[model samples]
Target: MAVEIDTSAFTEEAYELLSELEDSLLELEERPTDIELISRVFRAMHTIKGSGAMFGFDEVAKFTHEVETVFDMARSGTLPVTKALIDLTLAARDQIRSILDASRGGPPADQDNANRIISGLRALAPQKGGAAATETKAAAAPKADAEGPHVYRVRFEPKPEIFSSGTNPLLLLNELRDMGQCRVVAITNTLPSLEELDPERCYTHWEIFLTTTQGENAIRDVFIFVEDDCTLNVRLLTREEEQEDAEPKKLGEILLERGDINEEALGKALTPLGDRLVNAGVVSADKVRAALTEQRVVQEQKQQQTKAAEVDAVVRVPSTKLDKLVNLVGELVTVQARLNQISGRLNNQHLQLVAEEIERLTGELRDNTMSIRMLAIGSTFNKFKRLVRDLSTELGKQMELTTAGADTELDKTVIDQLNDPLVHIIRNSIDHGIEKPEVRKAIGKPLVGQIHLSAVHSGTSVLIQVKDDGKGLDAQLLRRKAVEKGLLSPDAVLTDQEAFMLIFGAGFSTAEKITNVSGRGVGMDVVRKSIESLRGTIDVQSELGKGTTITLKLPLTLAIIEGLLVGVNHDYFVLPLAAVEECVELSPKDIANSHGRRIVNVRGEIVPFIRIRERFAMDGERPIIEQIVIANVDGRRVGFGVDTVVGQHQTVIKNLGGSFQYSDEFSGATILGDGTVALLLDLARMVRYVEMQETKETGGA
Candidate 1:
């Protein structure tokens, strides 16, 4: 069977074809050697070529033919699907899209890029197999099919405002003749008299007869671009059929023939049938009622099915939309709380019930909407496997990436923001944390280096870690670098943990030489800034030559938070509940035993702690029996001493605005039900404050 191809149809159809080509190229990375994938790619190219020749996209067909030949060899099992081949085909697929894009009056295709892709395709051609001969045969088949002569009659009526629409009827008429033999005859029956004629309106139509073997569809397609607004018809007539007089069937007659509806049923349905059916006994009253009810139910079911299908077909929306929706829900929740307060005071049962119902619905909606934005971090983690493979190959090292706790889910927006920081950390681990294979082997370690990236939910926060089994950070070198960068004093007394964190200081690099991977002293500072901006914390743990683990503790979502409110100087402050470990009371005797040190003795172990009042620089004297709220920050136990612990709250975190933006101690502010704003503590910034205070005290001593 032969199909008539229209150049007008090619514009849209070619775009779809090239999009499929690009999708196939992306799929190849996952299933490079799958024969089905290779065959599907081949068939898509083949279809593009066949349809291109039938239409006028000859350049697209010619360029795709060479790429298709390379895949054909791979299909025949003569050439393997190597990474180089996949990359080459990916580049060629892009070129094919560029060529098709240009056909639609887009920017011109770059010849240099086209030549580069062509060279890549040529490199994949089989050396011994008759692939070239096979390809030549496929290219010749279309030429032979383009050889017959046929006749077509065309009728065209341009719309009354065709000239006003900026369409040139003359250009369309010329395009029709370019295909084959053509004739044109104009009909002036609708043209107005000279006094009534309007030059802006098109009043004439055309009837033309052309002889070409392109088939009826081709003739019809020539007018497809104008078919919606203009009257167009095409027919093929032979000498035998011309002897008889016949007219084409109308659209209504065709629908009737197709059994879509009957005239008798339509007439009966159009009448006032409710009272008539009851009186005629053609349908009993009960039976008629039952039928109507059944029909209504069926219609409802169909509507529900359609809605479900539409929902299923919807593409995944960006998390920003969900975030906005959640914000709206939060406002609704606040309003609902206000209504509940009013209803409680009014003692009206109906209003109370309505308020209760609204509260339940608002809560459920908030949860369901937030769940929609939640996604498994595994998708983000899987990408690191490919990264490790490529980077290890480039660095001439043997490194294996292992992941765990991938089932952990976080807000989609958080995952998107997490990708870049995670990538930088992973790169740093591979380049600097994991030693070279030779060095590892000389030290009697395994030849293969291992990097583990794992995440787990800790209360409301997700804890992720990138750990590597290689030489850990050299504290002495880091200290010297920190001193040289002026981030620390030359005579600064520091613990090993404090020294290691200096790597995150700006302008500090311990790498002896700058390499392509990550030795410019840029990535670690970015990692720190990004994590801090997300209200997250990062901690580094290392042993001289064993390994290092960098842990990141991030909130599940930045919009809403689970908080523990505490009263400091009669003002409420919100502390993330995930970070609250345990609360302990500080007595004057217990403070006296510590000798002014921040360390507190808790259950026979020394856990360093900080007082919230002191950290915030409150002026009031300390409480006699101070309550120390101990929490774990980056695996280190720290305590915040407050006056009293107010209860748990679901706080909607709002930015502190430009006025309070400079204060790192407070991440955001949340309004309590009583219209009071409670500041949310920044645990990461608090820890940094404690570290800085310790450094200053040691220097003074």
Candidate 2:
């Protein structure tokens, strides 16, 4: 079969590598002296350059080569890693991304940016420097001399599909030639019939004799990117001490040197048995030495093949395909639930056994599919490092962002939608929550502010908190702003927590002046809407003179939920199981003692309750005995009044119709096994509405 060469595959791999490259650059800035990080940065750039040239991204390859050269100098310790070098490298990284985009017809790269970076790099790391280049070359030569010069016989044979990956075998040969003296002979015996030839497949291999003062490590570095893409072998023909005086011998030495002697033994033997044993196994010294050299090259090649056979390889699958598999698993879950219900009602032993087996299989399948979709949230968090760095510089603030719980995992879909909302929240923290350096110093706080972002798994959800150590929100000022905007009555009294929440209201802003970053009042409002759309909740906690923490609670996945199915006067509803804390009985005496307030006293804790029937305007007679489901809402325990609890359900949530989509009381509706539609309540919205009503009633009293 012909090689399936897809340009999109190359682009996808390039994008993933670029993200890693950006991450490495940011890390290198923090630890400039780390050798491993330096190596990582160099390798990333070299791969991008080589792969770009192979796939027709000529401009990308050309621009990246210059960046690679800078890092190469860094790896050799010829050029010190400085802040200016880091900045220019970052700019070059962005320019490469622009080139990739332009290659695929997104837009042309910024020529000014490319030129500015190239100019900066050239100014700093030039080929011919007056004193620095001389010092560097003099410095690097000894490091090589310490290892001693050796002749290496390298055989490079790329897979037939190497062209598809954008690699040119000739380019690799050219790199070998640059290392020192290299003789290359291309073998075209693998060439196929013209009728059967594949244009993209490589049909040639090369045998190379490289005489380099650089040692074996240097030769291996040339083929690092193609480690898995080709067959490579580099064998040493001389030792350190011998190579001190052992440059390649004349043709006469080639025909007379003995093969049995190791380099150490040969050093002394070369002077004595100079013409005794030319080759080990053949009669003619010239032809035998040639054959034995080929034998060692092939032997080293076999060792590499043997080593490669032991490794387990993983293939990359497209995310779209994984998404399809998840959807299929969801449907299977629904069908399995239906089978369970039927088997329970029929009471047939055989049918019941089959249903149990199907349930077990379905559960395992669902778990496996979920595991595939789960990705560590750290990747998302790492991207914000650059954001914080750039913003801190732009705003002229001394602040550090500390993070924790990076290993927490979330659904890919949820993480994708979370980026913009999180950006808005973080920007707000920097602009409004964190005080300036002078202001902070005047208030006896540290000169540099601290912004801490943390994520942790809570029940079936993940809680992400973005906390800042700066000026806390002034509750009084927020109340005043709410009154001016008509969001609250002037006489309305609110708890500190309630007052802090007013920032999420539309057109709410306490900023005295507008700036480019966060003062326009469009941020928090949209943040609330976006979080609510994901069936999540956001809450704020602050002190008078201390810092503020904003917490977001979101489900691990959006498609399926573990729900508590309930019935209120025959209308069904589903409550997220993560939110449910307990179930309690609502007594008549408790209601009478509260004097018209809907509440319950549970183990010395008075929790406010809301009747689902009244909230939805469902017409039903009050049941004498009722069940109250206690849940944690906004960090407080609240209760929901329902008629009966119908056990747990694996709810496959579906979107609401267009007319009902605007309503905030319910997030979405789920289909039940019996074909009944259960509306999934947005508990946060209902709790907020309930609190507002109680505040008004208490004010009247």
Candidate 3:
């Protein structure tokens, strides 16, 4: 069971490294001469190979080792970074992922494709009697280190928290022992007494004398994962000292050389120096014994430069755990609201003060927890680079995907669900929106078309836009196609915006013919459904022969939001406060002035209003003066009239389930402080619904 858990960890790390590797490979293509990019590719592959071997992934290790060797050659300037090599390496990376997934009971990897990738890689290499076949064995053989068996001294002092990080020091030592003749001596002076001991903490440090043909770098590589968590220093012995292996050095000389004891103290120690020094307090007992052990064997090394170890600052956590934490916080918020309600009803000043304090703390906790799930959208943006690259090649078009504001953060759940919608939009842009290279050049545009994806924060919402420089959507053609397909009436006159929105209607397509990339008429419909599911709105803007821009306005999170609570008769509703502009009074006189129309004049601005009581089919006496919650709906000012305004709320959203699925009016529901369930208005959808109703009733007025 433990072994499986460890392998699971390695798999997760490999997946992340693979993602980073993909990004580096894509960037390396654009900056072929970038040494830093080359090194990044090499390091990612190297870590994957080493960790794979450590966790019993022999196939992963063997395959990745081959790829790592090629990058190693590039690192050493032996191989040039070429497009072909990058292509082959990407194929190899996919193979590595396949092997990892297979080990976890996934489908077996495609061996034929794997072989083709390896062959391609070898063909690109500078061959000497087929070196690729022998590189793996050469990596394990010590013949490459044919020089004299050099001696290295290593001091490893791990932090007390090392064991908790799932590192085994003994395995590291075993790896070192495999490299050469090695002796490990442990110093126990740091060990605490039993009463003070913590079983989980590491208290032992070690000094190692190793004789190996491999250089110091090979030894350092053994501790690569834990280097930041330990103090490690490795040095090589001088050639002259290597020849003096026949002579045993005294303890005093060793201590004096190490600067552990003063020369005066060392000189005062008598024969049988190690015990005498400890007795005289000239040096600690552990230092004397460590030196005596050094004398028994060959003393290891002199001073050499050391790498300054950095502190490890990141902790890997499972997403499921974060989800649980957010859920718990949501429950706490509900409880806090209940407390606030009780405090208000009791009319106790002390209790009210405590309730207010609890509310403040709960809000902070909610914000912090949501931020934990807020990942930069850049990670998702990168995957599309590969998609754009592959699709452009397939479509025989010269195109580029440019992105901005990738560091904009959104809820992880929002980002996860967003991937498919973005893919659909980009695919449509590439296949139908971007003209061929020749067509673009003839049109006096650049030969390469551009698809720009950008995100920005707007109030409490995020606006993501996908814009493409190509032959933009033709509203006339869209309207004609819709009429022919029975999606619109032949004599009907439609606005350009309405015609553009027709693409999202089911079974609507303007393509001349069907192709693999699109033209089944399903992509835009999927995009619309998906965005709406996340409580987001999509807008389209385009001009013929210019370009098209699709903008999606989305809430920053799905779990919680700042909402305006309003009441209508016996029920309540929550409006997203970000979209609420202001509130006004709608009196009976105001209704009579408008001649029974659901429109009002608010401070010289004419705005249409929806009667929430009538819209929801609730039969009750209307208030003499209703509060009209004026909100910005899709660039238009609209109002929702309710019985009273209920102020602001820290609303934890809950879904209204399948029973309410038939209506697109209410997006979701939330629990109020007084235990009332208030429905959240899908303002954009409701406005469109009302507009369609009015248009039909007035015969397209």
Per-model TM-score on C-alpha atoms: 0.62, 0.73, 0.75
lDDT of 2 by residue, 240-325 (tens): 34422223444334434423244553444332243443423223343334434544543444443445444425467888998889
**How much is the lDDT of residue 128 in candidate 1?**
30
Each prediction's Cα RMSD?
19.6, 15.0, 14.5
Top of the candidates by TM-score: 3
**Tens-digit lDDT string for candidate 3 (559-657):** 988899999877889999999999999888999999978998988989999988887789889999889999999899999999999898878888788
What is candidate 3's CA lDDT for residue 467?
A: 99
Which candidate number would show the highest lDDT if scored against the true structure? 3
**Candidate 1 stretches greater than 4 Å from native:** 1-33, 36-69, 76-78, 89-114, 127-314, 340-356, 444-448, 584-609, 619-627, 698-701
- Candidate 1, lDDT over the whole model: 0.74
Q: lDDT for each of the candidates?
A: 0.74, 0.79, 0.84
Candidate order by TM-score, decreasing, is 3, 2, 1
Clash list (residue pairs), candidate 3: none
Point out the worst 10-residue segment of candidate 3 by lDDT.
Answer: 302-311
Clashing pairs in 1: 150-212
What is the per-residue lDDT of model 1 for residues 201-255, given as tens digits with 9 covering 90 to 100?
A: 9987776666543467656666777777698877553322231233433322322
Least lDDT summed over 10 consecutive residues: which range in candidate 1?
A: 140-149
